[model samples]
Target: MTTYVINLDLPGAVQSRHLYGHFAEHLGRCIYGGFWVGEDSDIPNERGIRSDVVEALRALNIPNLRWPGGCFADEYHWKDGIGPREQRPRMVNTHWGNVEENNHFGTHEFMDLVELLGTDAYVNGNVGSGTVREMSEWVEYLTRDGDSPMVRLRKENGREQPWKVPYWGIGNEAWGCGGNMTAQAYADLARQYATFLRDHGDNKLYRIAAGANVDDFGWTEALMKSVGCVGCNSSGVASPYQAISLHYYTMSAEWENKGKATVFTDDEYYATMANAWHINTLLKRHTTIMDHYDPCKTIGLVLDEWGTWWQVEEGTNPGFLYQQNTMRDALVASVHFDIFGKYADRLFMANIAQTVNVLQAMILTDPDTGALVLTPTYHVFEMNTAHHDAHVLDVVAKDAPVSRKIGDKKLPALSASASTKDNSALISLSNLDLDHARTITLDLRGREVTGVTARILTAPDVRDHNTPDAPDAVAPREWTEISRVDGGLQVELPAHSYVTVSLDLA
Candidate 1:
């Protein structure tokens, strides 16, 4: 039996709900058909957003949403998507799929969707392809409170009040698609753009600079040093950026031959876990460097773009980036969320790559039928929402007996994290073993474990996924066997599964 002692007395960072955030990009059907069917369409929608998808997202209690682009963000011109839907000019989405993007789902539409979902907006500003005035005006247009030209234009466009977009990404992947500028160059440009990206009234913006793309320690160092505390306070004080953005995705190997989402060998599965574990390493090294530059810990690390990226589903546009999610994706997400919670102090926020109809998405909407199914990744998010706003508790546990080596790394069979709020505690665990059911023994650390509830998402087959017709084929089921035990609570975690147990502590 694997043993873990939950230390509820030690208070840790309050896990930001934004860590359970989602991403929506203009790629493929992510926006046009996935989220927007138009009010006129047969698909049930309010305004232009899909009602059912909104409901599903609401159920997950999504904290924040990053929109309009992934690579699309940099090339995106906010003007092209505003004004009148018909009068709003269409543009080619040169980034994802190169399809014709009708400006139907512009800034207003996105904010409306955000309001409907009741989540914060993390707007990825157009810095690469857009001019300083353009980025400045977009922020002004959405956030300016008074009757300025931009505000007047916004009132004319339909939105009278401003949206409190607390988080703003300076650029995305500036080292890559956002723009191939050297780190020093991007830093200079970031300062210029941020100077013009003003704040209006109570809608203070938390500017995020495009940070390193996974293990690029040099890029992180360069941005921190060169930017020298982006949006830094004058008088030689240091506030830098509220956060530095980081992007990483779980993958088996090269992009071209990255193992298929649902079809992979045992070695590939364990290897992917090792790769997922790399997030731990990256966070520590990056945080260490950030401490060196900004010791105050005012600067946070925003993992804005993260999730599994693999070959698009068969027959789908290669650029569309629609991949399948199964037990593998769920376990990967569990590990990532645990890490994010453990480092909530330095890790401010994170957003999964795509929320729907894209890589590691939550909902799969059938465009023709409008039927939807929640992916395994969706259930994982739903199960762990209790961690939001709860103080993370340090849990010491012995490694699972089964350890698989991928290259120089030994991937643990089980991963876990714990958090507490008031009289309740949330413990989430993932078992990566393919064939062994491991029993986890938890030491409640002297707290009264009055009530216990558990939810498990594990299928008979690790590759099992939900189709539009068979949505429950791989969904969560109540774990009925969880009960009070001597040391604490002992529960059976099925191999290759993710589980969340809520405890009512006295």
Candidate 2:
């Protein structure tokens, strides 16, 4: 039996709603068919944007949406996406599938999508192949008010009022796809670009510099030296960039061959879980380095791109990055969120890569029939939504199951986290054991007796997933095994399951 001693009175950092954010790039069906299907399409839509996808994502309480590109952001020219759709120039998406982009879903369309979803915007700027004037004008075009060249252009295009853009990324991945520049070189460029990304009117931009690839401490250190504030007086001004980003993806195997999405053996499954656990180390090390530069923890850490990366489905466009999401993916998400809750103080925001129909997507859309199916990973987010903007509760596990060895690393059989808001509290648990069910004791402290309700997401097999015909094949259902105990509560967590218990506090 595993015992989780949760300290309800000792509340830590507030879990920022942006921490549960999502990402969508111009890749595969994520944009063209998944979110936008043209205003005239037969599918129910609101001015070219898919209504079903928006409604489904709205249920998750999506706080923010990052647009334009991952790699495509660096090469994207904002001008091509503006003005009339018929007159907008067509460009080949060199980073994606070599498919020609008609520029129909440009800046205005993305802003409209953000408005409809009632979420904030995190737009990535072009730096690798774009000029300084272009980025400056784009910011001016979207945020500035009163008389200005960019403002006039924005009005000429269509919109008369300026849109609010709170968060802006200086560039995507500068060390690799964005540009093959060295750490120092990219840091210099980041500083220059951040200078021109001005705050117009009442809108102040939270500039995020392109940070390190996984475990690239040198890159992080260099970025800190350039943008981080160290040993400064209290009178000193804040850093030009408010946060630095880090990108890490969980994979079952090597980058060259990242195994399959849904077809894998037990060894591969353990390997994937082991990989997911590695993010803790990455966060700790990066936070330590950031602490050295900015001891106050004023600047934030943004994990802007992260999720499972598996090989593309056979017979599909390899560059499209379309893969299946299974129970394994759901477990991976649960573990990530558990860790994110632990580091909420420094970790301000995180966006899972490609929210729909691409790479660990929440929803998959069929091209032929226009059918939409929610993936198992989607249920994990929906189950854990209560953690958003809630205060983190310290949970210590005792007498937990012994870790299993996978290759050189040990994969823990359990993952958990808890948070509280108003008079209610939420506890999320994931049992990674593939065979036997584990009984868990919740030793609640610093609070009186309360009512508890729980729901669980699980399937008979770890490979179980949802198809358009069977969307609820692996969905959440009411969990009734939970009961009040001596000091708190006790529940049985099945093998490879994700559970969330909601408490009505006294």
- Name the top TM-score candidate: 2
Per-prediction TM-score, please?
0.97, 0.98
* Reference-based lDDT, each prediction: 0.86, 0.92
Superposed model 1: Cα runs more than 4 Å off: 227-236, 398-402
What ranges in model 2 sit over 4 Å off?
228-232
| Candidate 2 weakest lDDT stretch, 10 residues | 227-236
Residue range 1-506, candidate 2, lDDT tens digits:
88999988888999999988999899988999999999999999999999999999999999999988799999899999999999999999999999999999999999999999999999999988998889999999999999899999999998999999999999899999998899999999888898989999899999999999999999999999885574365668768788999999999988998989989998899899999989989999999999889888888999999999999999899989999999999999999999999889899999998799899999999999999999999999899889999999988977655688888777889999999998889999999988889888999988875688999999999989999889999999999989888998999999999999998887
Residue 31 shift from truth in candidate 1, angstroms: 0.3
Residue-level lDDT tens digits of model 1 in 338-408: 88877888898889988999999998888678888899999899998889888999888755356777898
431: Cα error in model 1, Å: 0.7
